[model samples]
Target chain A: MMNEQRREFIKKTALGVFVGLGAASGLVPAFSLEKTALPVWDEKPVPGKIRWGMLIDTRKCKEGCQQCVAACHHEHNVPAFKNRREEIRWIWKNSYKNVFPTADNAGASKEIQSRTFLSLCNHCADSPCTQICPTGATFKRWDGIVEIDYHRCIGCRFCMPACPYGSLSFNWQDPRTAIVDPVTAYPTREQGVVEKCNFCSDRLIKGLQPACVEVCPEQALVFGDLNDPASDIRVLLESNVTMQRKPELGTKPSVFYII
Target chain B: MKSRKLLWLVTFAAISLFAAFYLFSNGEAETPQKPLARVSVVDSTKCIAPKEFMRANHMQVLHGWERSVVRDGDRVHIASNGSRFQKSLGTCLGCHNNRLFCFSCHSYANVKPKCWNCHLSPMETQ
Candidate 1:
């Protein structure tokens, strides 16, 4: 009996010491060593299996088609407004100079005046938007996809000014009233909230291509895991002279464009 | 007795004055003059339908556009000529352009049909 009481006392004293140490160091509350396993879903992308990315082959992309843009808007239920001020876009085409200003200026001596390119969220490995967001609403997932949780956004617009690519947008008006029947694929955002491209996280979970990728007739868009040397994106990176947006900013964007 | 009464009255007045000042100042400090945020309300009754259509698609209208039209219930009415309408976008742009708030999504969606296609994009692409 006495031995058992001594053992109990020792255990209680040890636990108290651990808790005190944790509190002093600001570590999480101490708990027992028993490991609790999380339930695994059959469809869950094996935690690090797929790193979503995009490669734009400007050579194959036809100017003015805007098919990718239409498909993305249609799928996401983006509103169409007549006023330029009320317009919203996820992906759009720009003149070669717009997409690649540095390269375009360098190529001014060359003969191609009609060269055009597509631009969207670069989904950088070192994303500035994620760092600047006061609320952790914007974040990069484990698989290298930058995403936003609309619920946590406070509409501070700090991320807007921080982003060099101008990929973010704020809901000046309540978005619920804009569309006939808002697309139910994703939750609609409220007024005074900021939003941006999430690389279509919902579609990725289903093992499907991004809306833009599915609709590109010219096959100008490529999506894959960049970490794997065997992946198609990796192969393309090896073969093509592709460049990222704003390398000087050191964002290291996953989206690459072949010149 | 008179001196005692005067001292007591002076003390009471001082106490009352301090209490009043504290109460009023605290009340004013606690009540914010401007709210942290202002959500625009839609006036549905004053909304104007598109000229081509009797009613504009719900998505086509700006936020707070239909607030004036909302009656006792969910039902709303629109003007026959589709000319005069209250709009949240208009109110928002009174101080700033809609491009700051809308362009990223508009460009992403690529739904530029009427004014968007013809008007200059705010984004200064090279």
Candidate 2:
């Protein structure tokens, strides 16, 4: 009889300990918790607020100047390549047909024959890259810049493939070997991280123009807030024949081209 | 009977203490912090020309005949009719003269012209 009582007590004690552990280890809370709180913004977007964008005048873009491409590559510490396959560019000159094949064949008059295009990130209003990211590593800032948090990125390369314009590039090797001293405006990313044109967001925050914009000799590239009707970009769009890349994709790209 | 009860009490106390220690240690594990994202920008003030001047005259300054002579100095001197040349232009001569080399490689590859696509003729004489 005494052994029976001891056995019963031991069983009860063991069961109690097991239950306590399961509760303390978060197994119970996992099934019973509410949603986590996220950071919220309260400011209203001004009607004429800046929605920074770029306008490339393809007619004036010289075929081989490569000044914009070289400047962007050097400033961003983009890797050099021995072949076309390894080439990575944040901003590059593209042919009129390469960037806008449909438009090129639209039977426009010969007056538009001189047109060629420069291509880069569109900085879309409703970016699909941000939507497909498993983690919130890629996000669009309120100011219309699409940015990536490198440390949070798991190097899935999803963003690279998802981008319609081929704007995003994955770091196949360590980025450090590309430059002795990387640009201080942005921190350098490591191998396996994805990167692209950020519309020079760090410069925008500092009240400076993008490197490509400042360096273009033809004034082919114009950047300003789209939300502000009076901004230079808006004014230019009103005066010139402008179009966006891949408008059917419904990305609502902020980058425009004036032919 | 008394001894049996006393053993049960001691076992329960020990079990409770062990459970408390396990819970406390598990709670002390550090949570990882998220890394901040970084963006880069160029300093306009670092350039030699004013922003407006640089924006307007960059192509002319980059692609003129003077730029070619400045870039390939050895070739220029060898091809020259006389030994004595004019004055030294500066380091900008070497760095800004990348077009000759770049264009040579680009031409060999039969790649589409990159310069004339986005800019006008660099020579004021043109």
Candidate 3:
């Protein structure tokens, strides 16, 4: 019995020394992370795996609230022109009648009928802009985002006309002179090139939400992977019957409106 | 003959005066016309490359970064020293702006980079 007690004492003393040494220095990590497992972010957009999409809950989006539109334009350094004709817009509002031509009914609710639908690049799956681009400057990514390579774009404005949604805005003059206080380091577009909403592709690379979506006070915008069944956008689409602008064209627009 | 000699001397004096004015006026101005840089002193850790290297070949490096970012879609630049950086005007322009750092050498060289046509310098914004 004495030998067993002595053995226990030695074991306790060794454990105490081990614990004391561990406490003296952080030899053992407090968080207890697995050394073998390296945390890999790799959030960068990969083609064919993630099809990013958005659902605008129109009910939550207040009329005359141009927050989303203004935020996008500001973030991208989109020019503001005095004349309506010369103005460049990445996102803007249009009446329900204009956005959904065939769907508008005389008997429909006045609230939705008169509602201003936020519009931008549809980022079509089978984008007509990509198909029409002579220089292959406007090409659709495998993840279904239609992006414009300004370097390659000859500024022929072929993609401008091809887009049925009228999302593309051409910079008629140097955009730098227009913005009074440009967003620092944001690229101001040169004259003659067509620019449009890229769905915040730059932000997406760093795993950040779109500026428009982030600025919306009403939480109207829901952006996520359309392919991911568990994504908020997918769940929203499943729960609510959403509508896409001019769906009959079969461009497979990534944006959905919950009207 | 003295009158003709005086006339030639006066003409030479006027020509020299004009030449001096042009030479002095065209030289690099000590005080930059644009807004001053936000910070004056730069530490070695402040920049990715040494100041000498950046001053010499920033254009080439920037163009390469632009191609990788805009065309090839490689946004993040990982340095050999294991530092990761996102290649955008916003990143560097946050500190070393056009008015102070960029134009100091650029205006002196009389080379107009097309970067201003697209990217907004902090001075333009303010």
Candidate 4:
């Protein structure tokens, strides 16, 4: 009888101790939970108030000049592969006809007609890539930028087909060994994951311009808050006739071009 | 004959009870393997969270960070103490670059995480 009473007491005490330990670990703040920090934003954009947009003036773009493209690729440490299929590109130059194959035009200046066009991720407002990503790897930020989380991407390639513009590139091989001098700061992509331009979210956090925008010799690229009527891109769009790639699809490309 | 049957049942019960006690009590004497040593840290005196909590819940934290930042657009994480931290790899890379510590313990435990599919260790760049 004494042994039975002792056993019952021990079981209750054990249960109480287990419950207490669980509650303590879960509800109480863990040690070193204080003093969490992030980079101080000198100019933090108010969420929902700022819509980042870029305006490209094709008239000012110099023919065959790839300064902006090179800067963007180099800055992002985009891996260059001889196999075109394996190439990782942030920005590139193409002919105007190829870039805007659907546009109709008559007798124009050869210089204007033959001008090199810059192509990149449009960062569509209703981005199809983000909509189709199963893992939610590709998502649109509140500031109108289509962002990708590399860790979350499962390389399903659903986003690849969902993208109207051929922007997202899959790394076929380990990109670490391909580059001669790798930019250490930028994370290297592994095989079987997709990547694309994010409009320089890292630089944006630091209150700096995108590498391509800063590298333009003609000052052709204008980036600003499209939501604000007083912003440069808004003013430029109001004054000039802006054309976006495949506007009929209604993706609402944030990057605009003026002919 | 009835006494003989009772004796056999008693012997069997005693053997079973002895086996259970031995099996259950053996764990108390077993020593757990040492966790991997800490890798190079900028400030070894500090950690982002408590050592035991981090050791147990790091993978969960990163997984939550993915949903919080990408899907929900919650970029800044406010700790219980009201301090803010950005959900980023820079925070982890700043301390444990994962070259020595992460791989060592993970390999020992035979659990391979897929973070390297898109992220490089800081040591790899150098």
Candidate 5:
């Protein structure tokens, strides 16, 4: 009888101790016995199920129009440098010859030769940048978007050269000094970290499209889940003759150019 | 015997002088007043957690939030009070907009955090 009473006492004491610890650790509400509601702002990126991709219709992109570039830079607080050598860009226009050297033809029409293509991070499936990062700072997200964790990047510049697209930029000096009308929404990067287009992961979580896609005057850019058959990007990809940059390299870029 | 007595006398005198110097000199020097952190403009009760908990584990909380929001893309933080907040420094600065509050406490503690190096502090906006 005494042993039974002792067992009951011990079980109750253990339960009380667990509850106390939980309350102290802020895992459980102290006064309120009600369960806390889990407020989800957006859907979590599930690996392989949802792959975010982009389709850029280069034919629709107008010449000398940098609205998308300007919007991306401003939205991300990318510093402007007058010196071309020191300039940083998340997205910029490059000549077709430079962007797609393998596909370029000298005998092509002047319109095709001089045509500019919007260039940014390809966010490759088998990305060399993510593979070469020594610190694992550059990584492919579960949603197929490649991104860098600024906190983990050691400024080794390995990812910069590993990325064949030249999407990454290093902060040589204090970026804040060069920023004009700084956007408080995004944190400015410190010197010595490599930063690139995050596909606006911050905005994506808030249920907003990428800044470049949203600001495109001609609606040349389309962003949607590549894995979803019903997604707009998938429909565009199916209907158009899209080309990935340096397909020979087997990067399998998510950003496709509808030439 | 006389030499030993002389040595003891000298030792006693030195001890007496040292004790007197320490006690008197300490009282003569005025201790600088430590700057107190100003209370945040918002009600203290509105904090995500209790005042004592936040005061002790704010850094841990912030670091956890940073990792989850940036790396894992978990943006929503559910507070113990069932209030949801976006896991960003902007959310904190929205209410505690006073720069003096942060600086005063940090200066007093002699801890210089590099959060403001990249993040836009309330000081910069003001």
Candidate 6:
């Protein structure tokens, strides 16, 4: 009986060691190693995986409404300089004729000629600004958004003229001095860098919509993933006729307007 | 000839004594006292990392964070204890809000970081 008891104890000890080894090796799901992974700001943006685009319904957009421009400027801490040459603007309005010069304009209405259109960075897929930027400061993000790393910009105006749309502005003087009311959420650009709309990439990372889109009372602006067929912007594109600024330039602009 | 040799030796000895006196007097001159680096924490709480680690390598951590936040677009930094913090100078200023917290050490070390050129410091905000 003592001999049997010794044999039983040996069997139990061997089984216990086997279980411990299995746990250590992660063979058992409950014993898997727990890693403290960082809270990622979305997955690393992959090219063509998500193309963030915007659709603006020009019909609903009011003529005198500066809410979108105000909201964008305030959120980005874009200063308003007294000199027009030294002024910085992210988003602004322009006459339809100026915005869409290539579009058929022979029989356009009087109101159409006078109508103002929202103008900002096109965030083009084949952007000339990104191509001409000597420093990799201004480039297209993997998700199809054009962004500028102000820290990397060398104040070269190569991107300014390369862009068909006058979307970029240079900070000739200290922008902080001109800021009427500064917003601490975003940083202001230094005196010697080109600034423009970033499509609010900062907000997108925080799971918030763009400031302009959120503040528009008319809901005229629609932003979504262009790659997703089920996205609201895509649905709007499918149901309505849309126009892109300077489509002939082959920039492949992501911003669409429903006239 | 012996008298001339003695006169030359006397001249050399006089020059040597003057040079030694100048050197010793310069060495005894008092140097200006070094400015003391004093940091007062506005919010005294547990830091993201150990005090020793932060004191030794805070610059490295900030630079690593700058690259991650600006270039890679990874804004969240998870501490060893699993607490999440935004990877910005603002986060550091949130706790060490005293005006001299950064400047005191930076001035003491004679370093001039250009972080405030673009980013607003607590002093500017106030």
Predictions in order: lDDT:
0.58, 0.59, 0.71, 0.69, 0.76, 0.76
Instruction: Considering the true interface contacts (CA pairs under 8 Å between chains A and B), give the fraction that model 4 also has.
Output: 0.16
True contacts kept of each: 0.00, 0.00, 0.13, 0.16, 0.15, 0.11
> Which of candidates 3 and 6 is the stronger one according to lDDT?
6
Which order, best to worst by lDDT? 6, 5, 3, 4, 2, 1
User: Model 2: share of native contacts present?
Assistant: 0.00
lDDT digits (tens) for residues A80-170 of candidate 5? 9778877888999999888988774765578877899989999998888987898789987767789899888999999888888999999
Compute the DockQ of candidate 2.
0.01
lDDT of 3: 0.71
* Local accuracy of candidate 6 as per-residue lDDT tens digits, B11-57: 99999999878644422122232222222212223467887799789
Docking category of candidate 2: incorrect
Tens digit of lDDT per residue, candidate 4, span B22-41?
64442212122222222121
Q: Model 5 chain A, poorest ten-residue lDDT window?
A: A28-37
lDDT of 2 by residue, B14-60 (tens): 99999878644422122232222232321121234454674566456
lDDT of 3 by residue, A100-205 (tens): 8877487569878888899889888767798778888887764567888766778899888889899998877777678755665256678878889999986665
Interface RMSD in angstroms for candidate 4: 21.4
On a 0 to 100 scale, what is the lDDT of residue A54 in model 2? 89
Give the number of the best model, judged by lDDT. 6
lDDT at residue B60 of model 1 (Cα atoms):
46
Off by over 4 Å in 2: A1-49, A109-115, B1-126
Pairs of residues at least 3 apart in sequence or in different chains that clash in candidate 6? none
Pairs that collide in candidate 3 are A188-B118
Rank order (by TM-score, best first): 5, 6, 3, 4, 1, 2
Better of 1 and 5 by TM-score: 5
RMSD to native for every prediction?
28.2, 29.3, 22.0, 21.2, 22.5, 23.8
The local lDDT score (0 to 100) that residue B38 gets in candidate 1 is: 20
TM-score of each: 0.54, 0.53, 0.71, 0.71, 0.76, 0.75
Number of the candidate with higher lDDT, 2 or 3: 3
**Leading candidate by TM-score:** 5
